[model samples]
Target chain A: MAQRAVKQERAVRTREALVQAAAEVFGELGFAGASVSKIADRAGLTLGAMYFHFKSKEELAREIVVTQPARVRPEHESEGLQHAIDITLTWAYGLAEDTVLYAGARLVMEQEQFNAPEENSHRQWTDIIACDLRAAQAGREVRRAVDVEAVARLVVNACTGAQMHSSIESGRADLPQRIEEMWRVVLPSVAVPSAVARLEFGQSRGRRV
Target chain B: MAQRAVKQERAVRTREALVQAAAEVFGELGFAGASVSKIADRAGLTLGAMYFHFKSKEELAREIVVTQPARVRPEHESEGLQHAIDITLTWAYGLAEDTVLYAGARLVMEQEQFNAPEENSHRQWTDIIACDLRAAQAGREVRRAVDVEAVARLVVNACTGAQMHSSIESGRADLPQRIEEMWRVVLPSVAVPSAVARLEFGQSRGRRV
Candidate 1:
């Protein structure tokens, strides 16, 4: 029983390593350019070991896309507009430093070519923001006239653009600042005046996810 | 003199056809995946003719990137925020139907891999928008406190993201609607109340670029 437990732990570690390496390769080379051998080599694992964990590159890419949303955790316990802001800021910071999340985003953008789930990540993000907006609306933090779906779509799409531009311009080191600028313009249009005054768009608020 | 004129016209036509074909191939296959032979074939021209016009694939991609901005023309003579809105909407609509424009945009997005000019397209766009915003600010079409640079960046990036998302989801058929939605959220924050009221977000306004 003790040996079995150790073996299970080892298996988990190997899988994690493989996913991390795959993310790096996919993030840098894209789906068409990335290869299994390169991913295995980057992970410091044998091809046989990689095959044991992920059957194919498509499965690995799918895993990255499906599992990305859970990686963005709020920095603290908050509700309404603050919660939404925290998530966006935290995601911006994470996208700068986390290779796995960055690769996952790239895959989501270029998924159509690989036959991976294209809308899963985008839809998940939209749903998360929409839910938070609904909460904000109920609490009177946002304007009564604001369309939650449109606001959510705007925020998500704006952030997506910010990330892509930052990546191209500065390798995403400036993503948080870009996102803050985006919110400054966006928040005023959606959130109520009172809520806007209370919301924070600082770097300190973006805790690691 | 007549013979020389005919030869010059033929040369001009060949160059135009090659650029158009290169745009289609590069737009669909991207820089790395595209081949000169394929571009020539798509243009219905011989390889010798293509070589006469473009020395290499890199030159072709660079030409596409450098010339993209000129393709986005305003639907009519307008100025201030109206002009800005027209450019964005016209660009969105043109991005849907113009293969040359679409390929140019893709090249700009993936310029790093091909050593193409990265900042030219973005900088040109930001400058054009900033100039309009400056005009708007002087005209009181834009709010007094709005940061022109930040707003320009936000607008350019948001449009970039919207175009990318629309391309993946609907082959860019919905890009105009998406940009209109973006402007609906963005203009309220940057433009003066009076300016926002007068801005047109209609498909008919987006003439062919």
Candidate 2:
């Protein structure tokens, strides 16, 4: 039983290494330009070992898409608009520094080549934000005139653009700042006056949240 | 002189065809994926003719980036916030249908591979919008608290993301609507109350501008 457990742990580690290497290659070369051999080499694993885990490049790319967001967990419990803000700010900061997240974003943007499912990270974020906004509306934190769905869509879309712009222009060094600026412009229109006053847009808050 | 004029017109036609074809190829294949021979074939021109106009593929991509924005001209003169809105809306609408502009946007996004200069379309838009916001500030169309440069960067970055999201999800069918929604969220924060009331977010207004 001890030997079996150790073998399983080793398998997990190898799989993780492959995923990390695949992400780096995919992020740099994109889907059409990336190759399995290159990914395996980058991971420092044999091609046979890579195939033992992921069957193809598309599967590797899909794994990155489905799994990257799960890595962003709120550090502390929050409610309503604060929760929504925490998610956005945390994601902005994560996207700037995390290799897997950055590559996942790039893959999601260029997923057209792979003929992947239409439901992607953007939709997931919209749903998540909309749920939070609904809670905020119930709490009277958000303005009554604001449409939860529309605001959620706008936030997700704007963040997507801001992150991409930062990635290209400044290597994502300014993503958090860009996202904060975006919220300053958007929060006034969506949140009630009191909620706007209470909400925090600081980088430290992102880490704590 | 008449014969010379006819020859010049034919040369111009050939150049336009080449640009259009290059845009289509580059938009679909990106910079590294695109080939000069394929571009020439798509243009329905001989390799010799393509070479005469553009010495290399990099030159062709550069031309697309430099020339695409010049096509987005407003129908009539407008100033301040109205002009800013017009440019954003018109660009959103144009991006959905125009082939060259779409290609240009893609090229600008994937320009890292080519080692191109950082001053691409997004920066250009930011500068243009900043100039307009300065005019708007002078005219009292914008609020006093709003930072013209920061807001301009936010607007451009948000639009970039919105257009890219629309392109990936709906083939850019919903870009104009997305831009309108973005303006709804942003305008309230940046524009004076009186200016907000007069701003048009309609699709028809985009065409007029």
Instruction: Say which candidate scores most in TM-score.
Output: 1
Task: Give the residue spans of candidate 1 off by over 4 A.
Answer: A115-118, B115-120
- Per-candidate Cα lDDT values, in order, are 0.83, 0.82
lDDT tens digits, residue span A83-139, model 2: 888888887778766778888878866776664437667777889899999999999
lDDT of 2: 0.82
Local lDDT at A160 for model 1: 81
lDDT of model number 1: 0.83
CAPRI class of candidate 1 = medium
TM-score of chain A of 1: 0.92
TM-score of each: 0.93, 0.92
- Assess the local accuracy of residue A180 in candidate 2 as a C-alpha lDDT between 0 and 100: 81
Q: Each prediction's Cα RMSD?
A: 2.1, 2.3
Error of 2 at B115 (Å): 6.4
Q: Write the per-residue lDDT of candidate 1 for residues B16-82, one digit (tens) a residue.
A: 8888999999988989899999999999988898899998988888788777778888768889888
| lDDT score at residue A72, model 1, on the 0-100 scale | 83
Best by lDDT: 1
